[model samples]
Target: MKGFMLMFMGIGHLYEAFAGVHILQYMYGCSRDDETEQTERFGQLGYNGENFLEYDMKTLTWKSRKQQAHFMQDEWNSDISRLDFWKNYFSQTCIDCLKKQVDKGKSTLMKTVPPSVSLLQKTPFSPVTCHATGFYPRGVTVFWQKDGQDPHEDVENGETLPNDDGTFQKSTHLTVTPEEWKNNKYQCVVQVTGIKEVFIKVLTESEIQTNWEDPAPNIILIIGGVVALLLVVVGVVVGVVIWKKKSKKGFVPASTSDTDSDNSGKGVQKT
Candidate 1:
């Protein structure tokens, strides 16, 4: 049977308004003959909110819950590049439980081709960011893969920036007609120099805009602001200097002493 799989982790107990969420899904888990049956089986095996009881309607396997929670809006993480422990749970469908303890299997998918540009939400056209820092793509290749079937298999429009260490890490920004972004699905793929390809989907503007977790404003704005301020300061300084130069010599520098050379004791000998 054919079906999708997922594992969640790092549910840092926080308010529904603000919190980090993640989910892990792998295709290298198992093979199937019937896609619909597989989907049904997996859906039935899905974690139930009533204390972790995944119900398999076919075989009637009431798998006991082991610390599972209700699948909410922000529950399962969509990023495939997660390496954290709790976020690396094996979530697939099979007769027997498929739980493996691989040291670094958290983002197995991301370890593949380049990250894919996500389906950007288009209320406001957002950017798509991608960083290639995985095992497979140590420096393999980088690009954007739209559909999940293939990496070098879709439309790509943007540039790739290389990392400081000669490796490549790139970001792509595209403004979609408010209608298309929200309605379309996109992804960013990273191809390691020699390894495999790792791909990630572009989710939101925030994801791409702040992909670097950057604390600084955009390069263009920051540069522009600094340049403008410098220009203003220069203008003021120039105005002052021009005024000073253009003005008649000030009656001489101001002094504590009176203008009279008399011994007023203001402390200045009459040269």
Candidate 2:
């Protein structure tokens, strides 16, 4: 990112020297990274990515922090951290710059339109927000949708922002449904009066899955039932065989005693 910034600064200087113009641009990360550059107009700032030196308010002066810090401590302040610090600084700056531009751009667009204009940010998924802005947009309205479909569930919402030039800015948050967004194209449509509407579509978060899984439990239950049925059949067969064997082994002595008693009594009566 530092390299990217320096490259822009160099270009800005060249443009300023040749174009005789000073472009008013922002210093996004430089202000946040080190206070020194924030105070110094050593280089021309960029708008989006490219730098037009003529637009620079500082005549596109390019200054290196290490070379310009008044005190030795300030010169090496960036070195106090590790190499990763520089890497992080650049990434953070890029992200900040990108977000700021989008947000600012959105706000600027809202103020220029008429009243009660409903600008729909179209996407393949849900919109993050619904915000619209205009000069007298008291009657102006904002609406958002996913591929012209009504939002099915929760969606992130955007707000309408008025720009400095009497224009309006509004951003719609389109949530990327992993299932749908990949194959879909989302757009933000700015519907306005006396002007061609605009469209801005941004990628959103992917849909999440909360369903449960696992088929083993049912299979295990089926196996256990089959095993229990087999055990029951085997147990009944074994019990029947044991009872039959015991009945055959018994049934003896009681018969002999009964026969002797009856005979003896009959003889005595006859004598």
Which candidate should be chosen as best, given TM-score against the real structure? 1
**What tens digits encode model 2's per-residue C-alpha lDDT throughout 39-78?**
2112233433544221122322223323322243333333
Q: Could you give candidate 1's per-residue lDDT for residues 35-143 as a string of tens digits?
A: 3544223322222223343433443333444544334212433323431221232223332333232213535533434433333332343443344442333444445
lDDT (0-100) at residue 129 of candidate 1? 35
Candidate 2's TM-score = 0.23
Score each candidate by Cα lDDT: 0.42, 0.45
Error of 2 at 45 (Å): 57
CA error at residue 231 for candidate 2, angstroms: 72
TM-score computed on alpha carbons, candidate 1: 0.25
Query: What is the Cα root-mean-square deviation between model 1 and the actual structure?
Result: 24.0
